[model samples]
Target: MEKLIDDEGEIYNSISPKVAPVAVQNEMEPSNISIVTTNGTADNNIGKSKTTISLPSAAKFTNAAQKKAPWLKSLFQDECSAWETTKCGLAELIGTAVLVFLGCMGCVGSMGTPPSSLQVSFAWGIVVMIVAQSIGHISGAHINPAVTVGAVVMGKKSLTGACVYFVAQCLGAILGYGLLKVVTPSDLLLASSTSPAETFCITDLHGKIPVIQGLLGEIIATAVLMFMLCAMWDERNANNTDSGVIKCGLTIAALCMGLGPYTGCSLNPARSLAPAIWNNYWNHHWIFWFGPIGGSLLASVLYRSVFSLPQCSLPECQSLNTQKAELYKMMYGHGDMWDTFLSGMAELVGTGLLIFLGCGGCIGSLGVSPSHLQITLTFGLAVMIVIQCFGHISHAHVNPAITVGSVVLGIKSISEAAVYIIAQILGGILGYGLLKLCTPTGFLSSGGPEAASTFCVTMISPQVSNVQGLMVETMATMVLMLIACAVWDIRNASNTDSTSIRFGLGVTCLATIFGPYTGCSMNPARSFAPAIWNNSWLGHWVYWFGPIAGAAISASLYRIVFGLKTHDKETLTPISESIHLNSVDTDKSEVIINSWIQYRVHLTTRVLTLGKLIRIRAPYTRKKVLNPCDKFSHTIARYKSQNTTFYIPISLRCFSRMNLITDLLMRFEEFQNQVYRVRVSCKHLKHVKQSKHDQRSKAKVHNNISKV
Candidate 1:
């Protein structure tokens, strides 16, 4: 026996080790048996027996799960063993810390003479890109509890892993905030605190928007946030790339800018919780937790059900070259190490630019805050600019939430994610440093840093309550994510080219409408950065929990119901199978027939040559030498040892029509050997009859002579 076995114990190929020619066995049962050849003689030895042989059965092989199911065993371990639990947790920790630090710093400057919403939005957008680039390779840089939960639901992370990451992220956020406190002066820190007077301690929504309205805003915002994340990560979607990161960041910033005045969009629980812990302002904290969690869960369910990758086994889901660069295809299409480095560098530069331009815009306003329109334009336009510049490089994610979303959806590897996040954080720090370098020392001393911090975070108006602020953040972030999803979804052909424009405009719309109520933070990193710098943790939960929840819900809506349908649905049919051949027109029959004849003739020649070789080599055969001329004719077809030729004559065109000759060939195919024999017999019948008559006459004369 010969068997080919794969690394696993499964036998895939089988071949008989040896073959013997012998008589058929009497004991074996046969059904519908055809007699191909037989030899019979009048004299027979009755007592003799023909040779008999038996064939061995094929061998069977099975995996080593005889006593237990393989699926059960797999529960304790992954199908693949390369995943490192500790490394993933560490990445999550580092990534979260980076995001919180930069975002908090942005808020730190916002506390005194706060920059306009436009400036704040732009600054936060840059922060998102910086963190995403710095840490996107490791642990997916979720930096948010809601994003972690969404990852679990998306099947990217195990339940145990999710729990570990959540803890790491929360701790990382705290550590990041602590770093800010260490650097800023105690007096300046007080100015950065998240108080009812200066932070997201909402006491009213311009006296028109109620508490429920604020909550609705958060839900909607967070829904959009999650939806966009899923859309950007959808491989079935063409626009799922680094550019999606920029689009997402820009859109998210716009949401915050627009909704900032209403409820200060705190779309992430970690972002919100860190500052709240530092400041001990726990009022209406439950809203932040519930709103974001609910929204994220909803998004997860929707994305999985509607737009998720077709259900497939783990072994079949791996791609050989997933990291191929889409933006710089000529340089990085092969996905070499150089390409990886270049991608990371792109992220670094892009993130640095995001921070520099965003913060620079705010710091250069010369003391007076710009109007709402100017602020919105500054932020929205900055986002558009970065997207245009770096959209092709690292995708400029700038936001940890989107990175996590990509990982959960399997759009990126964990290692790559870590690199992106690390780069993002460094870029953010550099951007802030640049801002400080460019500003006058006197301005820096006169609440410049504090005001800059204010621009980085979300703060509720005095009239809005904590619950209302949480709701506002959640809804605002959700709406932002939803739009991001739409912009990135390639299925929506009309919006593909104008993604940045659409996203910028959307952010402008959100900021213009909701800037006064909660500050429309719509991002945890943006809100947390300032809170930590100013030591103002009040209502921080609203930023983290709300935005994260919003992201989750948005992922669900766009992936499932809102997203455009793809070109084709997944199916089990083989790629090579012919489905439409039957639908071809009769007019093309000539082409089909001609193609068939060429194929069959080639196959027939090979078969005939093999048979001839076998016969010539047979030792038992007693045959006369064949003449050279007869040999050629015999190779084609033979009847009663007569020289024969079977061919379509080219010179007989006048008598036989081309169509008729082709029709005859077609008939011969259906009837096979019988048709050929009949045709030959008909052509030579007269000659054969005459020759037989002469032989009979001669035999009669010879018999009479012998009798005489």
Candidate 2:
């Protein structure tokens, strides 16, 4: 890629047609132009170069685009299309597996008769930070079945992939846990008293928590989970999608770790089912599943309909390679705006599973405090792990309001954000439903009022003034939202900011500090879910309205007074660029200029962002386009001692879109032309002489697969 006049240019590559229907060389007309794929002397490249004038000069393009032109339509056959559902589907399956195995395992394995709730909670938190970094690259890490369903509905994935993702998640859970059983210490398992009831129950209190009380506890907790899922990490922010999941972990852990002592937090059905199956308890499982699911639906619908703006405008045709590079394509292959929403919906549903586990642990009969630190730890850890496990696919909002807020803030595109919200609600319902099936009343006669207290959303008796509680809650939420906005900001999220993930840990710290008061009901949607199910709607308005208002205020303040900005929103600063791809559709809408090439790309990037890589392809023959990374590399590589080789796979076409390919013989800072790449990697003879160390000849021969 080269910037021609007016900061625009062209790049040239010497290569043979790949997957060509006709012999490319045979079809060349009298006026022929083909790059020589080999290293040539400076004289060979420039000394005898014929810089002659031509009769018909047009913009330089690859053979793939030529096929799309109507004039040459009959000259070629169709090229392979890699941006198919099958690819995204496979990604989703693997992503879901990663999330479930790690997240759920953290919840079950960490709980025991003697354990620290705070430590357990961090387990989940750590999982979110680690797994997201790894799994995000695969299928967008939709690890949660619910998230997969949502993204599919949002048009991020084909329906086929979403279905496959759910199945994959369930199977993965069984397999992951089965493996854990083999590796887990026998003594640790013997003392493990972890359960939904035990984790949330207070040891001093005794008796069954009325259904209404238990239900209300779940509602607010799940609502808090949902709101964070929606508002904190939407890619619409200036950051990465995982940012929202990261916030969810912190917020949920706050409730589970600190508030679990009051009421059981059964926010997910899968959590309930897993423990119930393990413990053989089946009582009032319906409340757990139905309440949270219903609450999730209500919040999703309310958020979508009441408070939001239109989302990003989505183009119909998205290149697969481009999507992969931009997002974490863990198990679920990546998708564009439409598909991303679908993925978010899958996250919402998967969150239901999380609630089932965390909340169920709180409600599990044996979960009473002092002796049950392990239960509290299990609850918090569950959240941490799930966020890590499912951060990629669907943005893992897991809550409708977070998705809604993303839209309101112009983070999400209008294309399919609704699907994600809906899927989350449905998934929540299913999660709770499964919980109901697993827990029958007779199973937990041991759990007393103390246990019931753990799941209750009660306020601490600070004996403080009304203003104090309001101020405390307000300020806490403000700080949380501010951090969330910062993390979600695309500019920051897309860049290297380990600090954002730490913010999530910070929220957990806040819970550790403020757990005694206000119950940290940071989200109203959480309160809403269980309240409706258990007929515990008392003071529900406080949980719902208070946090939202606080969040809104914080958002406005951050966006206005503080001048913080999200990626797709009104931003505070703009970086200059040395080169940019002026993407335009051809008259036929078939020519897509996409590829990764070495070129002179002149752009001022505040930071390197893989998401910004340009892609240009007509039919096939893709290349990696230039973005900030190229500029940074040129600037940084000069001081480095070792020479590194870089390779881009042609299969991921979109990733190469708008790639600024440079001249093969001459190194450059930023500039591109069609004459470049005339002699790259076409002819590499592996003639290695006897040496003490392995020669680099073999590596050069496989340049296409190597990276510098």
Candidate 3:
């Protein structure tokens, strides 16, 4: 129902029925235009502006008719039967059993008469690695039933299969544990620590860490872990590109290791339950089960609501949606024009969040410094959590002026600079507003050196002078930015996710090194959020001015000075830049970005040869420009024919067949991923004819596309 673009001459995302022929739009466009095939666009979405369109469903074929067209079902059935074969299922079951055994074995070993943190931690993680590798082919080896449950709750899996998976996992865990009990030596059991879980029960009975704190810990940890899972599983996440068993394995393993000490890492109830049962650590079982499960449920709802994008309503799932309205479009900060606006807004909001959580959190109104150790750990952890919360959305810039400075320094844009700054300032005050709603005056009391009693207040003293603090802040920002750019390049527009956890820990490490000096305002936004919130805006400029100047100077210094900008002109990493717009401006106002190409297409399809680049407009019925060496053959397969090459998902209807300039386009991201894309050919079209169920969408996917 949006603007219908005539690329060359193909209908990109309109309602095109299989048998009900429709007239294709052909005039008022320029010679720069060319038609690309719509042949079963892999996705119903045509362009980045995918709009939802309702079309009449295909008429169901009768038995007689189906018999006449035997190819319909027969051709679509699995050939070698990969991904869902019985062999895959068996491999999954065995893999699940192995994971349970090893994870339990590690616990048993760690809790043995002589407990070892590293050994136990590694053991639990190793199970994830081993099993992920073993059954990853058949099933994404989700060994723990709870994780499967989490996945289903998160909508990554179906309820029916998740239920079956849980049952299988429970049975496997029981068997693995039972076997261990039989094989274990009594001496080791006697020596083990009665499970460090006793801390939850010790409960200074009331004052120190009330039952609420323990519950909160479990909730927070579980939620963070679940969020990480979503990012890692995202096919779009550069970290998850062509996701194999290894990436998934490392993801779980890293989570277990990093978060193990907190709430005993009960992100998975199965991991906790099996060990707790054998160890008799059931007193706080509710904290582990209810808390984590509750958190998981909340995280699922939030993620799906806020981040899980909806499929386009376009006839096909096209990347360049024909709809110009904002409702159906997802705008990123790095994207052009409107995208840049959204990106700036995101920066503002994200930075505001950063300031509120990191700085506000640092000075929890506890005028006293707990043993230096506690201050170092508690504050550092708070920063880690905040980073995880907002990293993906705005690159969690949480700082307005860093990019502004980058822009001024020629690394970013100055035209829309005000937007980001305003967003950042507002987000800071907003965080302060929310902070007031919580925090009892008592919790604000002198707990440690960083506490500010005004509840919303941001000012406080420091161990060092402002200059000393400024230097430290600048140094810290330099480190964080480098790591940030490395992990997330705006040009690449991708986040390292949990893969580059060392970068995440880097913040904590900085806090440990510089917490005493000016409270180490590595991020200007971090410093500003609390200042605006607490009404203690005095000396606010120091936090804002100091960190901003430092970040800008450092971002340019390292990125430009050292040639780190190879990723993007902006020192910022690309959490959204993973997608590049390789556009072709047909002067007719049509632009087409090959979503599947190694690089991005910036031209809107309306400006290019519609979605098809092969055929010209009706007035210009020029001969085809096929390559002398079968270039036309490949371009057809890559662009129109959806048999084997990478193409954009146009829609359910358009995917079946396409006619356009089918050609192969290739490029690579900083990580060296070779993206091979091309148009479909007649031979490829033949393959699509034989396939069924979202044929166009399947062809557009970037994975192992069949032979063109």
Candidate 4:
């Protein structure tokens, strides 16, 4: 008998009567297989036998080993294909080249009639849109180095990729301008009647426009551009991409039109660098680079940290989102200190921006003073921009009057209101100080031969009395407060799409109508800043008293007449019955319970869980317990009639582990509250109408009796 074992651990037996076993021939390589043969006699009755076994080859064994470990193979693979990276770089290069070539070509006067500012602005805007649409899928169409930096900061692009894009963009800009120079006539490229000498498309400050002011203008313009980009890139806005290209184009055009006179609105360093290199004109070139890059960095970080939606994958991001939500609830729904510091900071920065931009636009440069219309529009648009940028963070209450109004409406506590006012005043002062630093001494104040008034100071007309000026300020502020009330009304919550624009136009109208009388100083902080800066205190008391008085009166009246009544008398009556959980699923039970509580109660409800016990609480009362593991079938629900706690028990397995149900319940409650507010407003309006009708009837009867 003989026994043979193979590599698979299977044994085979062969028996022979002969003394010696048959020999086997091997044809494979020695290293490929290992074989052992042995012959022995177990007993006198058994004959000699041989055993043989086969082993796997070295190559096969190595392959099998590699299959067991995948990371080893992945370690050697490239992160991105070289060809794909090259293609992306090339796309950025070409896109940037196209942008420069087309954008500058429009500014060439020799091609045709000299293009107006409007034409030039629209040309750049349209070219940007065209390039974005063409190469947006490839390399994200980052034609500007500033945009590339922003992308890197946002983690949308790797550092190495950003470096590649930056180099490509710069080279493309140079190539594009070089090509333009070749095609355009020498007269147009050089000094000519239409084009300034050594300027071409090179961005520069207007005559008498201080370098600091120019720098500031470029920074502000680029920041706005970056803000728009961040908004477009937000995950929450993922579904709103159809009109992104158009909106971007229009935004650029608007910026150019607004800031072109001051700094040429060179929001792209690459775009400005191209013309400067072509013309060999480097005056204030650093401003273009530093301003755009700094602004892009600032805006990108701000949006990511404060404004953008949180990514749940990151713990810090989730925490940030929670803090922001809590802050919002504290400000609008309830009171808390979750993020009051951040809110105050936002108010401070927002107020500073409002003052700086609004007052900066008032300064006259060179020999040309801004028109009344320009000043009016400037202040209006400044307010609009500030509000749009900081509204989510702090409600952009850049005005003391607005803060005061919030206090009267119970949206802010007295302490919170005080903090906001102090921040606003300090921010205004700081903004004016920065403005004075940038402005030329001659342009800092009014009283040149052109009869320009003090820079942004609200002055009463010499012909009008202080009392009359006070009335003008008071009435203007009253109108402004009324607008705020309408915006804050719960009934108008869904109609906030164009709120910034509406406020802008409203300010413009007020300034246009009442500007000559009292400068329409509807904001005390706005008026106080320039007065402090210029030391012009004539009729200053009127500004402070008028706006504050107007805000308080308007807010109080609006709250009583049009606002939601949150007192016990107006609270919705809760259901006074028992809720039985019989054969309902977890989700359905939750929905039914939430609906019952939300529709019946007037308070905001919150649900919390600890182990197997669930606690439900309203902002106005203590917590109520619900045992999820208990066998109880029914519980009394008396929250509607009185503010007290109650208990209910049900199976815990029916509830979801996720917070999705809780979010849905909260949203449902908010919707119900909005509906309730609408109903209350309608009822009040009906009562007023009926009272007027009865009074009219009584007056007619009295008149008839007197005639008889």
Give the Cα lDDT of each candidate.
0.49, 0.42, 0.45, 0.63
Q: TM-score for candidate 4, please give it.
A: 0.60
Q: Against the true structure, whose TM-score is highest?
A: 4
lDDT of 2 by residue, 396-515 (tens): 555444554566555666555567656665665565554444444442222545333234343433574445556666666666667667767656755532343554355555555554
Off by over 4 Å in 4: 1-142, 160-197, 205-217, 224-263, 302-310, 314-324, 327-335, 445-453, 560-708
After TM-score superposition, what is the CA distance of residue 249 in candidate 2 from its true location, in Å? 15
Residue-level error in angstroms, candidate 1, position 266: 0.9
Q: Give the lDDT of residue 582 in candidate 4.
A: 15
Model 1 ranges with Cα > 4 A deviation:
1-83, 109-113, 190-211, 314-708
Write the number of the candidate with greater TM-score, choosing between 1 and 4.
4
Give a tens-digit lDDT track for model 1, residues 1-708: 233334633222222323321122111212211111112111111123221111111111111112223332433443323467677777777777777676666655435664445665566667776666666766666777887777666666666777777898889888887787788764565423443422432212223335665565455456546655655555434444555556656655755654444455677777777777877777566656766677777777776664343432221121201221221122112234554565566555555545444443343234334465756554555456445534544455655555544444344578877777666556655644544543443332222334544554557778999888878877777787776666555567455545566666766677677777776756454445445544677677877777777776776666667644432211222211011211222122111111111011100111123113101011011123322323432332221122333332111111111122222222223223321212111112334457678899899999999999
- Span of ten consecutive residues with least summed lDDT in model 3: 662-671
* Tens-digit per-residue lDDT, 253-336, candidate 3: 443333343344555555555555565656666776677777777766666556544433222222322121122232211125
Pick by TM-score: 2 or 3, better one: 3
Give the Å shift of residue 27 in candidate 3.
Answer: 21
Cα TM-score per model:
0.41, 0.42, 0.54, 0.60
Using lDDT as the measure, the top candidate is: 4
For candidate 2, give the lDDT: 0.42
